[model samples]
Target: MSIQDQEHTAEPSSSPADSAGTRRALRADLLRVGKIGGARSATSSAAVIEGHALIDRRTGVWVPLAERRRQAAAGSPADQARWDRLIEAVTRPTQPTEVSYEKLVVRVGSARDLLRTLADTLPPFVPVAEVAQRIEQRVESGTYPPGAVLAPGRIAADLGLPLQSVHLALSDLAGKGVIEQQANCRARVPGANPFNDRPRQLAQLLRALAAGGAFPPGTALPGRRELCRILVTGDKPFAAALRLLFQEGLLERDVRQRLTVRRGSVKRTDPPKLPAPAGHVKSLRDDEIPEAARRTRAWWNARLSPAPAALDQVIDQLGATAHQLVDRAQPGSVPPSTAQQQLSALVARTAITAAAVHHPHFELRLWHAACLATAVCDLLALLDDLDASRPSRRTAMPPLL
Candidate 1:
């Protein structure tokens, strides 16, 4: 019967054939988006499917779709309590299952991959230095089509980057409001795209050097003004980029009126790191947190079952120690001995808290904490250097012979 006829007949419209057809359509749309370099969209499709599958199966959080669906269709709640955030995503969209094809097709990836890739490759941590250079290289190689604009076709060809990568980069740049998407869906290079400023200067300089054969390992470069016009920045950024290249050992300039590329140990500019996309727990509402955190706490509780009561005691002790440190810290006054003792106490508290928090997903947190520790150490080192440079309060107390 026709779709209209089947609807009118009302004999449980979602027959096996109908369900199979929907799945096929979803899969086909998925592949098409993937082939066009829209991996983010493809991932979204996967997320939608996994989400919907959870709802259809009526399973609890954390249960995989395959098992949840089996239980849901069977009208069993055996796996329902185990329903996870995946199930939430599936059922959360207000639209009925019948209209979810478009959205589902757009997002089709595992939750782990989405979270991990964003954590790994998203910017602020993922540097764009190399990416920008790669783009510059392509622009100079004449791989990009010559135009008044950075057309997508030319952009993809010039960089030898796939359309999807270009699309994503373009989207990123657009989000920053650097480039505007035109009426025809083309990207128009804004008059002052911030990412363009430094890159354009660097590109011009590289091109000038390439043309003049001054970029080879031992060739010297021209004077400041001669190179300055080729580069495009004001006094500060221009000088900064050049100084950066020098520091990286890429360019060696002498008082003699010229510069040359260093033979080895040349460092390239690194990119800015991107922030990780917000994750499941962070994405939840305030009211939803106690429940989710309780789940997480329960998992931890189970893992620590061997010494549950003991762990609780230790956590209490740690919290008590933290409170004492704060309470003892006097207002507007610091005795040198007290300050030193307080620093030691803070360190002890951090170690204790870390030990008590025992979580499988805490690696990223620890990595960041370690970075902060390194920065603190470096700052302390600088202070020591400064202190040593000055006269001691009592020179006689420091005679270490």
Candidate 2:
């Protein structure tokens, strides 16, 4: 056949339709393979979960709607609150997969949990001054009233402070006279609130009484406890006031335990009545000891250098000392000339020792020499007694040749 006739007679092969069908079949096969690969991967490796709850809520047996309705109908406020908590615990969302790895794997992420982990590494800060201030305020407020027992350990626990800090605070309070230590060593708030200026008040009153001739020389004063009651204060302030009187030669407790007024301690000034709110004035008196200064002026005054002795008396003391040294008056009764020579040697050694005190050498060579010299002097004196105790090795005295 001619070529044209063969081409025309050849049936159309339908290549377009065949190609379209093959392409569709290839796409469907690829999709099925991708699904199978995903399934295999999911089974082989586990996904990291960052949720607070490890077990899934849905894993539990499901409750029926009818039973839920019944529980709701029967629920009280407590039951309802409990149910709410359970619901919250179950429904609260957590970051299980906050980040992805190349769109295939997910990495679990932390939220507040990471911050909590770092909390342990941080240093703790304690508010020391604030705690002390709070405790002091409590004292002022009568939360710990006068004479009330205090437990340092219990207070430390309550205030979140170290036990040592609480102990130090107690000591500070005791030193301030805000508290007193008991026989048991436990601290108690003093019955006397000297912060109220009870000592100064008592001083003023006693001064007025002295001026009025109530306390003459050799007069017996009232008992301390009675004064404590009359003054509406405690023993601490009364004791302080009484002590000031004692120091000023205003009062003395005799061997009979009776308080005696000294001849002339009180100033004998005009007696003024105590102020209306009791002992304190609206404006504190200028003469009164300040509250901030816990100690009395007398307390400070007692610590002073004594008066120096007269020049003649000092010279007499030195001369007497010289004679005692020259005498060698002890168990050792050596001859006068021998003792004098030893003393002169000792004086020379001492002079050398004193001169070398600031020497560059760390060791004290000269001081050691002085010690040896002293030992020799003592040995020489001791030999005299030994010689007297024993029979002499000298030839028997030829009868008064």
Candidate 3:
């Protein structure tokens, strides 16, 4: 055949049937390209071809060709180069091939399973404040009562935290006075020191009574046992309260050992400031008093004897002596020589109190008293340091040694 006849034969026929077949083949090719290029719909393919747009590979969105060109023109030379590469890739003709189907088998499971899987992958972080808060909550709720020891290893296991974190938390609590810890000892909830629960409560109640003029200055008070019965307290606490009062200079002892209110110590103008809610001497109804008193006396009888009361009285008197010494050492109120002498005496008394713990007749009460004495001595020492650091108000006393 001639050259023109060969070209005509290569071109598609213009007849109606042939034209319809050719259009169908072209449409199928465009559809195949759309699927491969990640065009979601027919409109996306139309946008790419007719509206001068390209399908973004990352987002699968059709970006306008004009906008891309404008950005490339305004951007850096590297950006323009990147734009050129992208446009070249989009415009490159792709071959038509067989479309393969992907199964995309999705296995659905419960949300719990997914969460557990995630939990296995991610490590949990436990903060120090969280551990401290847990301990504080337990203490406040009485889960850990006073005198209860807190073990760091046990806490670590319970909290799923590291042991070092627990120790740091405990040290922080100790510093804040939320708990107490000694060298080589575990942390513990602090309890009443130098006296048992009842004795401290009774002492406070008696102080309130004396200050409120229930027992006026120079007034001879009732017998210890009688006062104990009247106040719904035990004999031990009553005696301890009297000793405490005597130490505080609120009470005096006669030659016969009878307790009397000291002269010039009453503050009758103010109403009676009662003890906290935990005290035994609460505001009771007339009928409730008898039952409460009976219960208290029975408890006391079952638990303890009155033999230790005398020894406790001696320890308390020693604490009283220390208090007097500390008072004499008050800054700006006494001469330097006098303050030094008083401090020296205070130290000797404290050492004696501490030494008593090693004595043959040492008891739990004596140990508590020693602890109290040591605490008082430390407090006095702190005050002395503070006084030394402060600017002296008196010309006779210098700020520094």
Candidate 4:
């Protein structure tokens, strides 16, 4: 193709006034991938209206209406076939492939198969039903509502579960968007939806706030200890429960230390970042399949380029997430300096140091996490460097000797 032919084409502006025009153009092109609902803030009211106008009809499976329209206009068989495969690869599962060379052979599998295999490979997952039930009871009673802080230790002590298990449950709930966690280990329920029990907790808090006018909307609701007393539980369950509400976007903390509720019926916009499963890697395909497949591969390789992050950095980011989580479990507390010191001491030991230095995966996960932490440390250092900023902002209090 000539350079001119390959030049980029700009998408029509998704502006409010132009909705009718675009709807008329792209209406017949709708393709569904996932559940999409009524008008959202992210998509202006007009765009939502136009979107529904194009492909509002319900179907068992989703097809992107706009992309299909573009494919119909590809003007050539090769172009059309390419777009078709691209759409399929994204929407449907590709068949497994076998590779052979001399005595070596391997089979590449689908994401579904891999997840299933991993599930089977894992040791039986212990159920947390009892703990979940206990938390449910507290929520039903007047003890804990939305916007309560959690203390992992206290909860662990009360529930008779290891502190680590309680922490794990909280992590799982947070990932599920069943709660909202703040920096200082505080939590609140936004009650944006009733489906996941998040809405109930949130509704309870909203009703209380409405009646009591306690700490005006947008105020940091309360410290974890204070919330724990009201909720009649430790922090973990409270934080986990509040996470769901926060995900729904009913309540938000403002810059000036206020907790504000979105007065309107706005749906949540935050995307959840589910942790990638261990040993999961994007699949690479072999040369085969139909004509559509070849073109599909070429186009996807160009556009959906894979740029893997360094392994070391990923571990550090994971560590940072862990540290933040731990801090929340024990509010107004810091990780023991001696713990980190002991970890360093272990690294210095000859046997451990040698094993870590030699093991590639181990080294990758460790160093990657360290590299990320270093970047964070660098930013903190810069904050310290800024002389004009307020002393409070410029420096954290010095550690006690």
Candidate 5:
């Protein structure tokens, strides 16, 4: 009967086809999948049976449709019946079965290769220095396409960097005329970017060296050009820094010819050791902050706008601590895929009741608490979904149509 005639007849639409026809239909499904990139694409395309062949998703091979048609022509009635179900599956819209293809990167090698593979699998940590350097490098290297908006907040969140640092770096770039920035704080690279922190560090080191008599009182410092080369700061910034020292009475200069260190400017590196407190009295040691607490405090201070005096100090501390934390981690430890996830988990798990109760801005405190609660619930739900999708939680596969 014709397909239209069969529909009019009072009979079941699907029944067992002969093995030959079933195989032919199967060939068609495979060909559809092979024609696409993989299962993911094939599932979308729904192109299981084309005119001539079956595409094999597994081996990425295809079988000729002409051969399948011949096979079907010779198949028993039962074989044709099986083809009905398979054709419905391949040609009709339906949810796809879950299939995962694992990529195994194999190499013929010895110990070095083994170690390298192991190393590559470990999670990589992004520290502040590298974060700053990466941004500057990309901007200078023209990695960001022209006219792209540089959003510091988005970059900070994506990279798990302190937002303040991104703002500072971008601001510095703007100040140096390396980048074009609007008053609204959006920035784009016209060409320039960050100079390293070495200049300020060099300035401080010179202060310390001068205190240590490397440049004695009444000494005439080297010419500004020489200082620029030594300090790694451009002439303008280096001169500005020197003026600060001069204003502080650390140095003096003849109007026409030279600069000299003030005789009385050099001082002790640190205060003399304090005497031990008597028993039952509080000592400075008793109030010393722990490293982690210090870091958290610095984080808070560093984020404040108007760029307080403590910003640079805290940033330096944070950078050093970042390295220290990495060092303390076990060598083979796996870094989390995302630092943001870890931060989210930490915030979710933390208790802020006491702070909320006593906070000056109690409404804001409650709002923040609400935000955290929402984040925790969302994160937990995502985790549950991921767990459900894994093989261990999967039920038996749905039977094919």
Candidate 6:
């Protein structure tokens, strides 16, 4: 039925209170009808309602369409003409516009320009010597102990310096014998007396003796010279071994500074089982990518306007790249060199994308990408270690005769 016919339908006469109730019911019906149509139709219906409805100046309530039409009919010619025009406008069909797609051309020079601008905005480059000095201080202070893997990536992150700078500093330290570095492996602090396994061996022997009840709790054991002779070790190694025992709370010094087995120290408990190894690359990528994306979304929402379509595209692309990297990182699937190359490419692309979009949080995004790349690289290194050990393990196996 036409809207005019629906409006003209007669209602039963009621009290003044009923008039307000009737108006609310009519408004609800109009809204329900609008919702029954789809979004565009609903929008058009809402526009028609807004165009027809008039506010009561005194009552501050919306005048119903029927009442407005009645007033227009009784009023001058201009009011009738205005109402007629509104009805015609509401009934008119909307036209579809021609869809034109434009190609987004990103010039290489423009990206370079953006990079230059970003570089200008960044903090001054930290000196390689300064980075090396900081790491040296950390090493001397025992923050990085012997046998600890000194990952360049981790050091770079901690120092907030470039990875290359950290690498150079590590190389210098390694050259000077401050740390040890080998090809395709992270740098490591040199252990005290690398040639001597005597201290560790003596430590194990003493621990076994204590566990076997040779030295019971609260009993004063041998002197330093006696231990050296009995254990067939020198004074230096015996002292070091005793130090290890002291650290383990198995041995303590008495009033005369004699070595005694500490009371309540002997507990013959089974060693805890180690957990099975997992795919580090897959686990790290899974954990970090989504977290980075969430942080990016929150950061953008809090500080900037809603993200544009291009930002979403960049995020999707990053996710796809991460997935691809995880797949390639499977055991013996892709070599470390290839994985490293791909990761480097991903980092560069992420930086370029951030620059292209003029993202204020570009540094944050780049850091996350670099961190993921570093984790993947570390995983590759671990895989390399496992592979290297396999042949040695095979050779060491007793021949089945």
Per-candidate Cα lDDT values, in order, are: 0.38, 0.39, 0.45, 0.34, 0.38, 0.45
For each candidate, C-alpha RMSD in Å? 23.1, 32.8, 27.7, 26.0, 26.2, 29.3
Cα lDDT of model 4 by residue, 1-401, tens digit: 22122112312323122435434322321212021222241245443333232222321112343254335433333333433543443332232221111101011122122222222212232234434445445544423345444456655665555554455455544544555656765543435322234335434533343223232333355565654433333466567656655676656666765555545424322212223324443212111112222332232222211112333333323333323322222222223554333222221221111122222332122322232232233223322333223333332323211
Compared with the true structure, what per-residue lDDT tens digits does model 3 show for residues 174-254?
Answer: 867889997767788888433335566566655555554445467677786656544555576677767777777888877
lDDT of 6 by residue, 1-401 (tens): 43333334523222133545544444443332332222332345443333232111111222234235426343223334433443332221233221101000111122222222223212364545666777888777555556556778667665567776577678667867888997766788888533235577567656655554445467688677755544444588778888888998989989988888888888643212112223332233445644545554443323222233434444444444444543343334223454434333333322232222332343233333333333333334444454554433332222111
Best by lDDT: 6
> Which residue pairs in candidate 6 collide?
none
The TM-score obtained by model 1 is 0.20
Model 6 spans with C-alpha error above 4 angstroms: 1-122, 192-401
lDDT of 2 by residue, 68-156 (tens): 42264232332233334333333324543532221232111121111121221122423333445656766676545565567886667
Descending-lDDT candidate ranking = 6, 3, 2, 5, 1, 4
User: What lDDT does candidate 3 reach at residue 111?
Assistant: 17
Reference-based TM-score of each model: 0.20, 0.22, 0.26, 0.18, 0.23, 0.23
Scanning candidate 6 in windows of ten residues, the lowest lDDT window is 98-107
> Best candidate, TM-score-wise?
3
TM-score-best of 1 and 3: 3
Please report the TM-score between candidate 5 and the true structure.
0.23
lDDT tens digits, residue span 186-213, model 1: 8755453333345444544453333332
Backbone clashes, each candidate: 37, 0, 0, 37, 17, 0
Tell me the deviation in Å of residue 260 in model 4.
Answer: 37
Which parts of model 3 have CA positions greater than 4 angstroms off?
1-138, 142-144, 148-198, 270-401
